[model samples]
Target: MPHTLIRIDDLEDPRIAAYRDIRERDLVGRKGRFVAEGKVVLNVLFSTARFAAESVLLRENRVPGMTHIIDRIPPEVPVYVASGDLMDAIAGFPMHRGVLAIGLRSEEEPAEALLARLPSEALVVALAGISDHDNMGAIFRNAAAFGADAVIMDRTCCDPLYRKAIRVSVGAALKVPFARGGSADAVADTLEAQGFQVLALSPSGKQAIEDVERAPRCALLLGAEGPGLPEALLSRLPSVRIPMRADFDSLNVATAAAIALHRLWRPPTL
Candidate 1:
């Protein structure tokens, strides 16, 4: 397959506008687009059905090793190559990986639609008010690792498609099926309506996680680290706590989620 590698000699070229000032754009802009950095993430971006690349920016020297990957990109997509210094100038910092792709967000099914589509026996991770991008990304990574059917996030949660979150998840943010933007209660209600037994994780709960038997379909609800789940919500659901020493009250939201997900996980058989 023929590859079109457009050398980026001028930093001011409008074609590479999306790659400029990458950090600032990641913070307040990007519209419905995202950055896929490093070779690993770029590979996932190309393969993921949920996303499509508008263009790719790569260090000219790094193209040799990425030939096969570049060849796989749809011909309609432009491939831009720049010198290391030029790449650094455009990004406003050293992006050592030298491989970056700008991808547009693909539409996702609604939470209710996604829930109704789940297999009869499914495990889901629900996040409420998880404002930290790192934690959100880690949760998504853990969800993918544990074979979670889907991850549902409330409106207050950070965008998992943010560059840092996607990088931290190592592209799991793209691989894992997810739905965002709803009130916490609304999310829980949707899960319950789909015949999912929702379990809320709290440090003070009477039941140990191990003691709770797995349901045919389960949705584990987690919240931001310090505030944890709201008391009103906690009171309504069966709460389970992880056993820990008295000195520490809780684990980071992401770590706690991993533990709970692993315990509840039932891997699919061939």
Candidate 2:
């Protein structure tokens, strides 16, 4: 096992440039991968062999529940320990939960690539403008648990692979295959061309989600919290609504998507 000790006093040392501008990845441009904070998030990440942690940062004394997590990492992987302040300086945040990790950025994937991997039995979730990281993350968590095939999103949606989205999803975002780009209409055009029906989610939509016949191929189109589906999308695609309490304005987009997916996409009994 190899060990490299970094002192808290040397905060500006450039040995680890990747740890400095943590927020740069939040927007866009030539940024590195997302950071997974805390032991709980890292523990969730342990299941994903696809994500390789470039490094792990830990507090000197260590977190209570994370001793097992540290043992799971390969002996050769770089693990840095610092006092709380030092940990924050490296991580660019104050809440240096006794441990942290840098999760590898996922490779860019195309919708066609995702489409090709589909089994005859596949269920997928579609999201648009779900710019809120927490919502995007929660939706992914639910999708992974319920057996959804993929998450399709427009370019405007937040990066599902971003740090916060991954943390919020407990890293379920990584497990789910997602493709971003193209408007609902464009994605619909491609999906339709691929023989999928674009079921647009909306409140007043005439068709109920349960009423729709499940097909071997289907895409669930979702919008952000308040804007609802793009007006043009409704005109071009078949609009469907989840049955809900009439008095409520609407369910949160992630929750609504979960309910609809469960009802529409239950795997057939063998």
Candidate 3:
């Protein structure tokens, strides 16, 4: 079904209010809503059943190129178009990409519930204290690239649904299944309870990543750079380190995750 396009000429229109001053509102909570920007992210927003499009705001000229994506929007969702000047004013920025949408996230699912749904053979990413949006996004992108079944984040981690994070992930954040909430230890506990062999990544880990054996159900535990995983948590789990140059002992959390995920990921047999 085709999406109805609404024309807006005025800046004060209440219908586009959620899109106003997007840069300022990016940090402030959007309740259950989030801004999905760029053509690529919009594609995932429309393609995924994990999220629903509440509405879309596009530059009038960009509409000609967006029919394929627009067609994916449900008939009830509105697609609004405006002039470049009006879009710039509404977003408080250049609005160069000329694409944006309000995506609604459903109720948060429990970590236990999300883990329970994974297959008997699964690879999952568990994150702790990952406060940087860029790293969070890159990690999700890597997870999608490496075929990890899901991503589980602890309470201290930043929101993957953040506009910058989602944009950085190139929509992988929307495509990959994830669950948030709980302490780092609590997250580890849940993964273990679901039959996952929790492997913590840190510079001082007892074993090198290449030497570790793969488990049928595995969760790669990663933490923020510099501080890395909690020392206590590291002590409790099977820790693995990515070997580097003689003096260098660390890798960025996201890069480390990619290496570990690649090392552990086995291509599914036909």
Candidate 4:
């Protein structure tokens, strides 16, 4: 197959506008769209029906498996090949695997959806104000590993679909169901309405995580390292502490989510 070439000398080509200004993806911005970089993440996105490709950018010359991936995409999906230098410049970053794709943005369900859809028994990880993209990605990865049914985050939290988070997550964010949190009051009200036990993880807590009685549904609310859960969330939920080494005050958010998910959630015997 002859290579399909795209020349994008003008950075403002509307066809590839979604790939421009990669840094702005983290901030609150216009419509939702996510760029999956590298063949691995791009392939993962490609395999999913939930995410549809807006366009694809690839480097020219000896790109492997180009035929296989292209066949998977419908002809309607736009494919553009460019020089390796142009690929990097258009993406505003280095091309790790010499391939990148822009996909339609999607959001995780809200708490109500998670609560209603979750089986009679469910384990969920709720994140509040975890601003770091790497941490957000790691949280989803851990959530997927330990059988957490859903991930809930605050509105102020970083966008999980952003490029960095998607890379760090290695596409686990695509698998784990998540919801944006509304407000501390809203979180408490929703949990109370759903009858889920909200166990907020914080050092100031009195109860050990092991001691908490497991319910049919539970959500572990984790916060960023320093600020911890906001005061309102603390005041609302029953606080539980994860017993850690005295020398170390806390684990990384991802590790803590993993440990919490493991201790609290395990698949039932088939």
Per-model TM-score versus the true fold? 0.96, 0.86, 0.97, 0.84
TM-score: model 2 vs. ground truth: 0.86
Which is the winner by TM-score between candidate 3 and candidate 4? 3
Q: Write the per-residue lDDT of candidate 4 for residues 34-67, one digit (tens) a residue.
A: 7777766776776767677778877875256766
> What local distance difference test score does each model get?
0.90, 0.76, 0.93, 0.76
What does each candidate score in C-alpha RMSD? Answer: 1.4, 2.8, 1.2, 3.2
Give the alpha carbon lDDT tens digit for every residue of 1-270 in model 2: 334544455677665555666676466633547777767678767666767777777788774456678767766667776687776776676754556677777677888678767886677787778889899999998888788888888878887877788778877886888887587667777677767767888996769988888777877888988998888888778888888787875788889888888877776689
Instruction: Locate the minimum summed-lDDT window of 10 residues in model 1.
Output: 41-50
After superposition, which runs of candidate 2 have C-alpha atoms over 4 Å from their true positions? 1-9, 13-15, 21-30, 267-270
Q: Candidate 2: give its CA RMSD in angstroms.
A: 2.8
C-alpha lDDT (0 to 100) for residue 84 of candidate 2: 77
Which is the leading candidate under lDDT? 3
| Model 4, total clashes | 1
Judging by lDDT, tell me the better candidate of 2 and 3: 3
Give the C-alpha miss distance for residue 55 in model 4, angstroms.
1.5
